[model samples]
Target: MTYDISLDKKKAILLVVGCILLVVLSFFAGLFLGAMIQQPETVTAAPNSEKPKKASAGAPAVLAKKLPAKPKVRLPVKPKVKLPAKPRVKLPVIAKKPAPTTPVATKVTSAAAPAPALPAAPKAKPEPYPYSIRLASFNQFKFVLTGLSQYRQKGMSPYFAKVNLGEKGVWWRLFTGYYPSRKAAQAAVTEHNLKGVQVIKTAYANLAGIFSSKNELNDIFKRLDSQGYSPYIIKDAENHLRLFTGAFITKKGVQDQNQDLKADGIDSKVVER
Candidate 1:
């Protein structure tokens, strides 16, 4: 055995070469083992980083966005609460006037209030046309005044009228009145047919028909005119128409005319005017 492990130059050189090759192989193996172990460490680092990225993306569910807030400030509402309108002022009303018919109603009330004082006011009036008998008209004022005074002494109410003509003359006519009417005055004239009473009352007349209608008197007037009798007309105090003879003033002349009118188929009478 000692003889077989003998050192030679060639074997010694081969053995040293093999030892170098082993050392090189060992160094490469160690380097390969370290690289495989470090690959697991890199895979572990990638899985750890992916877990953080997934966690960061899912964390956005808790968003910090703010919602719309209610308006708490109310400045415009305070101005609207203070605003109020003023009320309108009132005016006065006018009064109305009374009607015009109120005075007429008052007059009717006064008329009904008193009835006895109405009739006493009318009895104090004097007579309008008192009766008068005209005696004679004188040419002088003094003579008629003297006649009026003399007639007044005979229980006659006497007055005189002055007849005036400008620059011509002034006369006075005497009369007696204060009687009732003209009919009574004519009765006095006929009763007192003395010297200076009526100028026609003492005269005679041939009387014709006394007519109440003018048409009846017209027929007689024509008949009397054809018989040559000049007729005259007079009105009595009662306004009655009296037809007579103006030409026959004496009794003998009226008697002759009455005979002539009777013979001519006309009936008549003798009268004193």
Candidate 2:
């Protein structure tokens, strides 16, 4: 049987086929885009997988083979530059100090000189006069002066000394002459008919003179010493210096010294200590 299709029916069948083909083409294009999107993710996720299950079977074999594998990125390598070596500096060597050597002692056979002899000791000074007569003691100096003046007027050369009796206060002691013994003092008191006077044993020396200037006393002392006389000094309470010579122990010895001093033009008195 011969089928006769008109031109309009033929055109209508061609439009329907084109529409179906477009739908199928659209579906395949969607699948191909989905596969392309998932392929990189799968490769990134499991790069070592033998088979990528996510690959679409509908994908063309020629496109798969033509796709380039991920190219390995070679980072630029830094070349090692050889730097010049630093010059070695030679350190200066320090010289060590030599140790000190001990000196050797040498002995000599010659005789050694003897040491010098020491100076001889000086002679001891003689003792002072050991006896004097203390006539009376007064508490007030004026009274003692009055007594001294009265005694002087009566042909007696009297002297006074100031003595501190500590808790008893200071006293002015009146004396007439230096005596070698208490008996000699008593004899003098009796000869003078002195009353209320007692003999006291004490030390005294012959007084040459009282001088205000120590220089004058020293001059006189030197003169006496040069003349072979032993002279000494005593500072009185009045700040005056009294020069004395020869501390005699006997009345004869005192008289002899007085005579000798007189011969030498030195005036002295045997006043009380």
Candidate 3:
């Protein structure tokens, strides 16, 4: 039967077509699966890239495994800070002393400057005289004054006064009253059991001559023209003109003058003034 028997060819063609279809189906399936289950993109460093940190596989636990980085030996750098400047303080200036000008001007300026005022000192009061006791008088005798030191030792300031009775004058009357008042003097006299405490006014005298004639007194006075003796004359109660050389409290003064008059052949005596 020569009937058109193309079965082998048809089977070959079918096999070829089946193989082509399987290839196309596998390509489309792979494309669709790749698109559905896509993986995230990973960035990798180059081998020679200089990074301060080591590469990590995106894992937190990998930090300890990272190689220790090169220790950057940083040098110490000084910080630039501005400081406030110190303020200047003014000092007091002392003026120098100037040279002196004219001597008159120097004197004037010195005089112009007032002296330092001193505090007033308390004024001292005058001392009252010491109380005294009047002892008896030795009318016919001279007071030797040898007992004066003894009286002073006994707390007594002893002294003498003369009572003039013209030619009959009493002897030096011993006393000690430099006392303030008569009462004080009386008290001192009573204390010492002293009697006859008569107050005596201060007196002094000396004599060069006692002449009956004023002419004889003048002659003696004119002869005593020495610079030492001051001579003067007065008529006494006896109507006798007595010439005095000087007045003195002490008898020794008059006695000495009497000795000097004796040297000059002129006699003298002491009297109260």
- lDDT of predicted model 2: 0.68
**Between 2 and 3, whose TM-score is larger?**
2
Candidates in descending lDDT order: 2, 1, 3
Q: What is the TM-score of each candidate against the true structure?
A: 0.27, 0.32, 0.25
Report the candidate with higher lDDT, 2 versus 3.
Answer: 2
Candidate 3 — worst ten consecutive residues by lDDT sum? Answer: 121-130
Error of 1 at 228 (Å): 0.8
For TM-score, the strongest prediction is 2
What local lDDT score does residue 245 receive in model 3, on the 0 to 100 scale?
Answer: 59
Candidate 3 lDDT by residue in tens digits, 1-273: 334467777888999999999999999999998876664222333555676776577756543567889999999999988898888988899898898776663466655868644333224332333233455566753342554555667786565434454597645556564455557767766777765456443234466655667665666777775433446555544555556554334566556556666788766665554
lDDT of 2 by residue, 180-264 (tens): 5677778888899988887765454567877766776777788886775656565544556667765433455456667778899
All-Cα superposition RMSD per candidate? 34.2, 21.4, 28.7
Residue 87, candidate 1: Cα error in Å is: 99
Candidate 2 residue 228 Cα shift, in angstroms, is: 30
